[model samples]
Target: MKEGNAISDAHQVTAWPPIRNLVSDMLAISQRTHNGYGLLEFDVTTPLARIAEHKTRMPDGISFTAFLAYCLGHAIGEHPGVHACRQGGRLVVFDDVDISTLLEKTKPDGARVPVIYIVRAANRKSLAEINEEIRRAVRDDLYDDPAVRRRRRIVRMPALLRRGVWWWIRRDPVRRKRQWGTAVLSNVGSAIDARPSWGLVQSFLPCSVTVGGIFERVCWRNERAEPRKMMSVTVAVDHDIVDGVPGGRFVARFAELVEAAAGLDEEFGTSAGDRAEGQSR
Candidate 1:
């Protein structure tokens, strides 16, 4: 046979990072996790407008993701059962709403990787506080984070030992919270393309949220059709721990909060309607 051109085809095979195994381990745990997902769409025109205006005043720009995180925290606080993890015969529920999210960080070699960042006591934090925290994490060298360092060591172990470590961690709710978090919020849409879509994300946490894109859509208001900004979001909870009644309630309350721009009005003193009125004149 003549020499084939297959060898000339450009292809690069990169070594898989050990840390990816950590995510794989988490996905493996999800096999045993029974999750009920609520795919929701929220009218975020007010919040987006408010966030845009707030950015002009504050040096640290407001993040829509942070606002959603704030809303998720309070919502979980009201329905604590959604954040409860099952430990053998009993259920372990936590009051503090700890949200674990992945923020991209650049390594010294200039390779970008997602680093796990936990927003502790998210319920008690204000919008500005959450915004600044997220911004700071983006600026910081997250590879130096102690939690990331510890996780690096864990990923280096043999596959069996690594799996065993995760099992041991999951056995105790407190341990899981300390190591992973009580809940997870993955905002994949915000960081990626502008395509408006809902992401169905899987996680090992008791409660998880996947925030998608904001796109303009026609909505009926006062029997008149008007263009409004809509956001795609998904809220998931462990079905074994959280029932439908409470889960539905949590989604309702969360939608109401986001649609009404709950945290923004308290800080900004006006709604999108009010801002539009001033600009019109």
Candidate 2:
């Protein structure tokens, strides 16, 4: 941040406000409670192919976040227990499948900052609708995003008091369910380290899913070597809320829904280009 520092050095020295607030808030959530978590990675090659086809056929590129939310939403819908939290005497299962996810946007200073967004009732929305929502979340600058507002508000609070407020938000089941949601997803598909594999993360939530980079790999099908596009998906479930058996089942269900997504042309009738053209006229 010095007047003449090199770009890399300056970036290292500068702690962007938005990203700092995000980390601070996440730390508060981590401190709220402890949950036994396990990581499971799935080879989601089949559905990835379907997603690729859908992308090619659609005029407006679809957001991977939208596709993921659709798949995860349906899977959670079938197993509502995954989104439930235990109270003193009862379990509270939210009917809506709200998904909290991380997104990166360029700050006014030209540095990229990570922001959190929650897609409420994802199970109730179609793929097209989810796609539009994510597009709007990123593209529309007419209104401040919820994450931006929260970051602005939190940054104004004293550090000592901010953590307390965040802890309070996470501690309340109703508020947490509404704001942070039952399941969490982080998209790391774009940041592929040439390390030969994906990263596994155990988020402080009932369930957390991370989608890693998609790369071409050799596959041996019917004794023939062929190249196939494959991606890594890590799903972590709270052991207290979901046991291994159900956890495995949930992952399998998510994979099934992703692979089973069909008829992109029929699902999305209008192309993004067409919509834009109509708007311009």
Candidate 3:
């Protein structure tokens, strides 16, 4: 492959000690388990309906990103292994919810590079912060900066060369521990317009699981009506973390929460009395 300045430049090297340690730990765990890989899938129609309804009015307020984060946190809280990585026969489960999302931005010339980051304490992050972090990572050129690119190259080097390079980079303990997170979130919805049929996504080794959203077509039947708005949502997940039962339950609960939140306006009364009360308070 003909390498460009973005790929071969030395300045591209930056310290990412945490990511290195995480990879090392994961490798160790995989080596210990008889079957290092696992998979799971479920249908979340109910939850999707609830989420869609809740977001109908406040489209910007209740977003897909926030919903995904909430669901992931809920699932991980119940099943800790969902956020665990294998390290040489031992499974290391993280205490906090650190989610890594992929970001791709167009450059002046139109080329794009995807970068990933650890969104600190994703469970507690507000809708705005989640959106802003994704925006900042994509717009700041942090992914393409010379230093970042160099570090990526070194990390991706052949196994033989990687040992020495990675060792030198890991001298900083803070960097090494900083990168480990409970799980990863991949949004492939940007590629397709419509939601896809519910299914599990296949991904690489190191990553224990992956989730994707697809186009959805939903119709509402009324007494005199035929069809309603064409709407959809995307879903992606790793199978190894949880079994069918728990996965289904998680999806069901998620749907319930979204649905309940959506009906808040109607339940609280959108009538004149409600309006007057609002004015009084």
Candidate 4:
């Protein structure tokens, strides 16, 4: 066929059969059940630019997703009570800061698929450790877990059974904490198909943080408009577990950590106790 010429050979068009996955199940739960929300956006202009330079000099470059998750975990660890979940008319606050994050795994055929993995006690891990864990998630076949396999089958059941299972899982505070962690985190900065610098995201969880794309813009600095790199971030919290003051404090601390992200080596050796001490000082 020549350029701009339409050639018809009577090819059949078909749709891919619907298949149930964990993301869809979670997305359904997020959309239908989640009610309370508190949002905060950060002006991460200079910090992101510095991180870009650091990435260039490294052999195994650090991704913004990994950095973002570490900072979130640290902040949550410091204020664990604020990320609590309420169930059975009781508030369950977690002391250990675990995080659920998404990774784009590449298949043998070079196709990419997103998989959810939990970073247990992420607040205790260093920046290097967190980065390695995220990379391992991309390399490993995480969906091979027996429980995940079982859930795949369970999702195919009737709607009534599905709802019942969802309720059973969600209603129990311990089970909910084990499966979904204290918070869910994601970064759409590299999502080429999404809108430039996508800001907020809605999901059903105790806490959620999402990092959007980086853009360059002119903003007032010393009463003059100057160009700078900027990134948008969104944090959402469920009201049942935490009040507005705590949530606001958590967001403020998270923004402070993100702004200091460019100096990552100091962040690497600090344990949870060290972080607490630094914050106190």
Candidate topping lDDT: 1
TM-score, cand. 2: 0.81
List candidate 3 stretches off by more than 4 Å: 1-63, 88-90, 143-151, 163-177, 195-244, 254-281
- Please give the distance, in angstroms, between residue 223's alpha carbon in candidate 2 and its true position after superposition: 5.3
Report residue 162 deviation for candidate 1 (angstroms). Answer: 0.6
Instruction: Put down candidate 3 lDDT per residue, 1-281, tens digits, no spaces.
Output: 67564565446666655446435643543453332332323234554555456445432333455455555555555555544544446656666667665566576788665555566676565434554455456547675655456656766666657766644444332343354344556655446455442324333222323443343334444545432222133233345544556655655554444434422344322332343345358
- In Å, residue 1's CA in model 2 sits off its true spot by 28
Give the TM-score comparing model 4 with the true structure, all chains together: 0.79
In angstroms, the error of model 3 at 136 is: 2.6
* Model 1 clashing-pair count: 0
lDDT of each residue in 1-281, candidate 2, tens digit only: 55575555334465455457657667556554445444434445665565576667555567877888988988998888777776657778888899988777776779776667788898888777777778777765623766558656876788778777776766677877765788988878768852235556645567778877776678788899987666667776766678778877777898777656522445454644354456469
- Highest TM-score scorer: 1
Per-candidate local distance difference test: 0.82, 0.70, 0.47, 0.70
Query: Residue pairs in steric clash, candidate 2?
Result: none
Candidate 4 lDDT (Cα, whole model)? 0.70
For 136-165, candidate 1 gives per-residue lDDT tens digits of 788887767877788999999999999999
Model 1 vs truth, CA RMSD: 5.6
